[model samples]
Target: MFFLKYLPTQSLILNYQEHFPDGAEPKIASRLEMLREASLLLRDLEDFFRAHDFSLTRFLICVILDRADEQGGLQHSEIVERIDVSSPVISRSLKSLIDERFVCVESETEGRRTKRNRLTDAGKARLQSLMPGYYEILLK
Candidate 1:
């Protein structure tokens, strides 16, 4: 029942009911379970990165940078929106990346607060290096 929530909302509920006709099916409970599983997986991955002194937040930031627009770059705010993390969280992560030489602020846009973040050579390589292991856990 709890596991059903992890799936896409519409499909998950119907699928769960089909599988477990006798079980109670509640959207809230299902979503909660899904959130729990997602959190668990994130924790597991975070622990994995921590062992190697890598921050998961930074890794996610790097991922966002890799998915740059057609021009191969993105604004910092876009990163925040895409990752669905708070500004402070993204700021902290970006700092880590800047320190590690993985990313840099390429330019300041029209707005005073908006800065375009670009992946440096090292940043691109680092992301590429991490993808295999990241996807291994991610896909699992």
Candidate 2:
């Protein structure tokens, strides 16, 4: 999403070469273009999720849990380790999911104090319903 609208990129790169000939990184243009494209893709995904009234964070957490699925589900710490998001955001989203009946917290079979978050049957159904649209956006 970062672009020099007033100046063409080649012009900007040429200007940089004129000013800092030795410091001109040969791959800067390609790197910037890559980053810009990635940013725009992410922006589109965010817009799509919002348009559906769904959260990308919650969706990611669901995906992580689904992939690492066990009867008792994954522990809170395990969820944190899988995702790049901050703990508090994960905590808030995870907690809301429980309230929405999409996820449930249960004790481990062994006598551990740790809590595990499992997706409900309803949750699985919701995930199934969302996947087609999600793939559509990705494939698009």
For this target, which candidate reaches the highest TM-score against the unseen true structure? 2
lDDT of 1 by residue, 1-140 (tens): 12232445655566667565544567555656678888778877887788767878888887778777345577767788888779998888898888888888865655577568888989989888877878888878
Task: Evaluate model 2: give its lDDT.
Answer: 0.78
Model 2 CA deviation exceeding 4 Å by range: 1-8, 17-26
Least well predicted 10-residue stretch by lDDT in candidate 2 = 1-10
lDDT values of the candidates? 0.75, 0.78
RMSD of each: 7.0, 3.1
lDDT at residue 72 of model 2 (Cα atoms): 62
In candidate 2, what are the lDDT values of residues 1-140, reduced to their tens digit? 35333323766687767565565555667766667666766777788778866788888888877776765689988888989888999999998889888899988767879888988888787777788878887786
> What would the TM-scores of all predictions be?
0.68, 0.82
Q: What is the lDDT of candidate 1?
A: 0.75
